[model samples]
Target: MLHRSLPIRASLLLAALCLSTPAWSADPIHKETVALTAGKAAHSVKGQIKGYATAEYTLTGKAGQTLSVKLKTNQPSNYFNIRQAGQDEALFIGSTSGNTYQATLPADGEYTVQVYLMRNAARRNAVANYRLEMGLRD
Candidate 1:
């Protein structure tokens, strides 16, 4: 009887551990496309994000081209992350507390920029209305 109870306890512990994790751990990520013209382009997008919601934008350019990104949010705790398309990890772009990112593409393909609210802020049931500006230089 004691051995049977041990297994039940372990199952409850595992369930608790999973529930305590952050919502962003598996939130749906929405995607958008950025259009470039004449080897250069700039765009501004506006939207609202609630809780742990995430959004991503994709653009294609040649290798060695420069990309500039800026995010302005109504909430101070919102920021953006840049990563290569088809990848799951974000690139380390200096301090992770800013709304701006700049880098050169390592290869010629689609790159993704992710916008999300900070974890601490998201937990408080916060919402952010933001504008994302992007520029690509050829």
Candidate 2:
């Protein structure tokens, strides 16, 4: 009787584990506002992200201003990208090894910096803590 009950116990445990974890679990995208001034202005933010999570920052600058963005994370599978205001695509995409990008503002107005964990990493139940640094150099 004891040997027969062992299999049922293992099956119940497996079902409980599966039910505890959802395929997708995350909050809404987090957003932060920022500002850039000429001649070495900088800003920094820290946050934690779970699987399938994203955080974004918004700022406005002149047409000719140069902007730089860098992200440091506990997990190496996170990156950042830049999207111009009113545009549907990113101006530049960062690689897995390097989560940084710099460019001159093309038409001024507002821009968005999006930080997210890679799709593979986000699919897991891991959480990554990160620090994002943004700056402007005149």
Candidate 3:
């Protein structure tokens, strides 16, 4: 009886896991560096991602400075997140908070900006054409 129930329990666990939302930090499929003009503190970039694809942008910033990010996309299911390098959790979740993010730096180092579509949209092979604006100010 114990051995028979083991398979049943494993199947149930698998079902539960499949029903949960996907982990927000999917491995990015694209990467780029956010470059600022010689004297400028802000810049805007455009790109497109589809399905479960993700684009990551890295930028360097100093502690005590403020970082601002705005994402405008063609699909409402598209979103972005911000995280410091070597971190697993995100500092901002666009799907829950909104498309814009603003926060003061926590340390002086590199940060990543990730853009992708929600699972619901990604599973449907939806595409997101987006303009991402970023700035850092003292």
**What are the clashing pairs of model 3?**
none
The C-alpha TM-scores of every prediction are 0.72, 0.76, 0.76
lDDT against the true structure, per candidate, is 0.79, 0.83, 0.88
- Per-residue CA lDDT of model 2 for 20-131, tens digit only, reads 8565555569998887776764788999888777898998888888888888899978888888988987787875337877778898798898888887887784688999
Error of 1 at 129 (Å): 0.6
Task: Output the number of the lDDT-best candidate.
Answer: 3
Model 2 off-target regions past 4 Å?
1-27
Which residue runs of candidate 1 sit more than 4 Å off their true CA positions?
A: 1-26, 38-41, 86-89, 92-97
Q: How should the candidates be ordered by lDDT, best one leading?
A: 3, 2, 1
lDDT (Cα, tens digit) per residue for candidate 3, span 39-75: 3657999999999999999999888888999999899
Clashing pairs in 2: none
- Per-residue CA lDDT of candidate 1, range 35-82, in tens? 865245478899888878888888777788888888888898888888
**RMSD for each of the candidates:** 5.0, 6.6, 7.1
Model 3 / residue 50 / CA error / Å = 0.5
Positional deviation of residue 98's Cα in model 1 after best superposition, in angstroms: 1.6
